[model samples]
Target: MFSRDSRAETRADTAKPGAIPTQPPRFSGPIGVVSSAAAPSYQPASPDRPTSILGPDISIYGEQLILKTKGSLLIQGHIEGDVHGETVTVDDGAHVKGVITARTIAIQGGVKGELKGSNVILHEHSVVEADIIQERLTVADGAHFEGSVKKAKNASEVTPDLS
Candidate 1:
């Protein structure tokens, strides 16, 4: 066994007070100490999926109905009764004669009745002859719209882009 004095001799010098001891260089590349500043702050954008504002499933009466869904309803038929939904869409080939109440209504067809919605979009192929109440409305070029529209809420400028 070595004596305390001999063991002390084996050991080198100690670090001075208040002095930080240097660490041996690591074999791996520089270790990144990730601070909050190194990382980017991020916020995901809201999805464009249209949510249902009101009404249940769609209902039709005595009219040829061809329906497509993209978080909205597409109607290609002759509607007699009242039509209601969150987002109601009518194709250019459709011919409807009824009252429609919805959150957002898009028409590329021929409609002859009263229409109510928060937002209304009429395409170039549309021919509408009805009184409309909406927050926002867009009518495309060549679209024949013969209706008085009442703005329900403050909205952006109207555009003539049917599709």
Candidate 2:
């Protein structure tokens, strides 16, 4: 059986004089008593702080393959279902075939479904064929878009149903 008092055994061996300590110094108080400088800080992930990426080699296919995240999402792969995030970016050479709902959507690839966001940008290399609802819509030159765009009066009022 393992001994429970392992810290007692880990005390510095003081039998030999002028010897380097074999163990690290131990704290004797409750865990939280340690100073912040000596403790590891824990940070919660904020909805607009983290960025998640889907690599180019990955492919998602399903009837209801919804990818939802509180933070940003960068898709460099192929998705056959809906995507919801705070900020969604479909990189160049990527492909998506379902609805995309986000606060901001930047498409540099190919999308074939609905896109609803506060701000939507279609880059020069993007190929889109979806109906878009956004407060601000920007289509760069050379961006192939075959969809209708509906503009909202206030960007904050247009909230995409992330469900």
Candidate 3:
């Protein structure tokens, strides 16, 4: 059996020219070795999926119930105020009672206020009763809508200044 010193010497002899040393380098400062378990995993965000979600049991009331998101927003509950997002989706059984402004707005539930978006879609199960201002508007068959629709020239033209 080789001794510790002999083992190190053997490693040195077998190493390639100008190769890194087999032994870990000594450091005077605190070591910062990061293992896989300690390191955080990164995932790319998806544009089609909402980053924020309001569950079915959730209910937001009052005029201060304004929800604004830079990413997509999904609502499965009841909201009594304005909502603004990059993409907004009102799921089935959800209800909104105020204005909605977004780049893209999809409704599968009920809306009772103005809706302004670059692109708007009302599913067959949706019920909307408000004025709509959009670059593109689509209403599926069986969708109940009682609103005036105004189409814009482009998405940029329809984008609202929420600030």
In model 3, which runs have C-alpha deviations exceeding 4 angstroms?
A: 1-50, 153-157, 160-163
TM-score of candidate 3 to 2 decimals? 0.66
Could you give candidate 2's per-residue lDDT for residues 1-163 as a string of tens digits? 7335665554333336666666543221111212323331223235456666787998999988888987777788999999988778887799999999888788878999999888787776789999998987877677899988888667654565556
Candidate 2 ranges beyond 4 A from true positions: 1-48, 153-157, 161-163
lDDT of 3 by residue, 1-163 (tens): 8334665443433578889876732111101222323321222236554356687899999957788887767788999999988777787799999999988787878999999998788876789999999987877677899979988767765575456
In candidate 3, what residue range of length 10 has the lowest lDDT sum?
25-34
Best by lDDT: 2
Superposed on all Cα atoms, model 2 deviates from the true structure by an RMSD in Å of: 16.0
Question: Would you list the C-alpha lDDT of every candidate in the order shown?
Answer: 0.55, 0.74, 0.73
RMSD in Å for all candidates: 26.0, 16.0, 19.5
Lowest lDDT 10-residue stretch of candidate 2:
27-36
**TM-scores vs. true structure, each candidate:** 0.51, 0.67, 0.66
lDDT value for model 1: 0.55
User: After aligning candidate 2 to the native by TM-score, how far in Å is the CA of 130 from where it should be?
Assistant: 0.5
